[model samples]
Target: MSNLVEFNETSAPGFVLLGFTERAELRLLCFFVFFTIYAVTLAGNLGVVVLIRLDLGLHTPMYFFLSHLSLLDICYSSTIIPQALWSLVVAKPGISFPGCVTQLFSFATCATTECYILAAMAYDRFVAICNPLLYSVLMSQRLCVGLVAGAYLAGVISSTIHTVAIFHLPFCRSKKIDHFFCDGPPLLALSCSDTHLSELVVSALVGFNVLSTTAFIVTSYSRVLAAVFRMRSPPASRKTFSTCASHLVSITLYYGSSLFMYLRPSSRHSLEDDKVVSMLYSVAIPMLNPLIYSLRNADMKRAMRKARGRVLSLATRGSQAPERRGGPLHG
Candidate 1:
């Protein structure tokens, strides 16, 4: 117990995050691209959340899960992007050991929560499409709330296990992490202590969590597809499929990238390859999720248009009022 505490606490050394400094010319481009991505990700996720709140028609089980998903995306991206941008500006970009642990906890919690949230969403779609008669009964407001709470609980539990396990292993080799963030596979590579146990634990945890949710999604969609084909209405089938298309796209991008990064043996982890893949799941997908999920949503589009109109109208009225006050301009 004393040894483990020492490993996790002040004994931890300051670690340098050796990001993309080799290509000076490309760093500028990378910075702009990532900055743009970060900005868009924030806007997109927040926009969806706000839209869901304001639009009454969007207060359904599907959008309920979607709002929470947007929240997770915001947190997940925030955990890494700001630090990454800051690293580009400084000569020595190193995070304190505590800061690294905090980053890992925050990102892991959000990411793990997302996994189950996606599964819950799949189950919701399954009930709605496959068993529409009992959809309302099975996916009640109380049940939706419980499922969301469970997803968050699962995230907390998973992150706690991973954080405790990984940090207990002393990282005493080179105090330099080659990737941009404090991810599990890369952090495991830095441990001076025997990492076979840590590696085994991490792989088992990550693999089970990812695979179970993925299997759930696949199984639910398979049933949904079968049900879709059985219906005689073409328009109904199209509409039903449209509801899940965004989620499918998001799953493909995020799951595909994450599986490539973490599911493999840690021995096969290439810093260069892992870094690029990290950017995809951590940065790019968050930005793309809002677009994929909400762009085709007619209700959200209508709500956004109304919000934009309201802003323009308010600005126009304010501008005219100042000019209309002829004498002293209402000063």
Candidate 2:
């Protein structure tokens, strides 16, 4: 038993993230680009939240889920963009063990939440389109609240399991993580311990989350298509399809990139290539979410205009109040 130890215990305590490796001159360029994305992500998502709150017309189940999606985008971008921007600007892009784990946990949580939220949105569309008469009854305020709560709970549980499985692995060799963020695949590659359990768990979660949600979405859309087709009137069918097109596009882009990254076997792990793919879902998707929703959604555009006007009016009133108070010719 005493002679069973195979390797020494000393190991690197942290990791150096290689980030983007195209060119050194691209560092500033990348930083500015990502900074713009982060700003837009925050403003767009927060704008949606504010619009949903201020506009009575948007106080429905659809907008409620939209608001939560916006919030998830904000949280998701916040988890990765800041650190990524810092890594690009700073000389070193190092992360401690605990920091890496925390980042991984938050990222996984937001991502899982987005998956479930998309499914909920799909279901909402089903009810709204397939059974308009009972839409409100099926998707009451209580039900909406329950669905949002369930999404968050599912996210937390999935993240907890993944993070725990990851941290339990022993790290005894190279600690360099070759990605902009702490993702499951990259972290798994760095583990010296036998990662069969972790790999299996990650694969199972990915399969269950993506495949299950995809099935639900497909079923909902199938029923939706059938309903629209049976209407027989071209205009009505077109309108129904238009209503779901934006959501379908979003779902395709999101799950497409995510599935490409996670669902593949571990033998296909290429840190350099995987990093590029991860950016699509992590950075690009968040930036595109608001554009997709706002451009396609008339209610959101109107609400945004009203909210902007309100802000401008308040600013003008604030400026005039100071001037009126300071006037000296009052009798």
Candidate 3:
């Protein structure tokens, strides 16, 4: 196989990412669509983070985890969308070997980190619902911080292994990637070397990461469900159901798309199909997470109202201040 030809050039090769569409008009349309999505993603995720920080009511472990998830969504979306938008406009959208490595590493890190954070959030809900008396004590500030730190560390480790493993392979074939972003399966397909080992490694890592966290979330929610069922108070049951619903939707969207994209063998991958699925998790979900939480959770909605009121009040005061300054000199 030509892929067996090791990349021995002192200088690294550059790669062109073939974005979603090839036709000139379609590219234009895609550019506008994705740009809007990216803009909304940034505004929404940042708003969530800021809302959590400024609102004292949102200082709980649940909000803390939510804030971090928003940050991660911002991060990974930023890594891919700008480059993808660029690819859509330019004649040849090329990324150097180093740039590709960086993109992959950053994306993988954010994605892996998000999985564990979601799991942590599930545990938080578990404690809140099942062991209400110990909720505060169990999900202490120390434990919350520790969980977040661990998630980040796990991301770094997982990303490092995958990045190093894939990039080390020889790329004697075409440098044009079929998808908009530098994903693993597509990259492996371009490799001149035998990708069995890399595929196994990637699949194993993804399976472990996805399944383990998913199992944890499932178990946590199972207990939560039992507890919810046992509640005799109708209002309390309704409130708890509403709280869990948002998270369940988020988990389904992210994990389902991710599992489909990564779990398959490389040879069976349809690059065209993969691109659409990638958009679901990497682009759409980030933009939707803020909406999911804010629209569903009463606390978040209340905080948003307060924040909006504050903004309006500040704007009104600012508008009046200029008029007063113009009308008369202050003593």
lDDT of each: 0.85, 0.86, 0.92
True-vs-predicted CA distance for residue 163, candidate 2, Å: 1.1
User: What's the ranking of the predictions by TM-score, best on top?
Assistant: 3, 1, 2
Top candidate by TM-score? 3
Cα error, residue 116 of model 1, in Å, equals: 0.5
Candidate 1: stretches off by over 4 Å? 1-12, 312-331
Q: Each model's TM-score, in the order given?
A: 0.90, 0.89, 0.93
lDDT winner: 3
The sequence of per-residue lDDT tens digits that candidate 3 reaches over residues 216-312 is 9999999999999999999999999999999999999999999999998676789899999999999999999999999999999999999999999
- Report the lDDT tens digits of candidate 2 across residue range 1-331: 2222222223435677767853657877898899999999898888788889889999989899999999999989999999898777655467777889899999999999899999999999999989999998999989999999999999999999989988888866676677898899988888888998999998898789889999999999999988988997898788788878889999999999999998888898788779888989999899899889988776777888888899999999998997788787572
Cα displacement (Å) at residue 195, model 1: 0.9
- Expressed as tens digits, the lDDT of each residue in 1-331 for candidate 1 is 1111122323446777777774656666767877999999999999999989987888989999999999999998899999887666554467898999999999889888999999999999999999999999999999999999999998999888888889998877777788888888788888888988877887777888899999999999999989999989999888888877888889999899989988887668898999899998988888999999877666667778888898899999998986888658556
Indicate the TM-score of model 3.
0.93
Which is the winner by TM-score between candidate 1 and candidate 3?
A: 3
Weakest lDDT window of 10 consecutive positions for candidate 3: 1-10
At residue 80, what lDDT does model 3 achieve? Answer: 97
Off by over 4 Å in 3: 1-12, 321-331
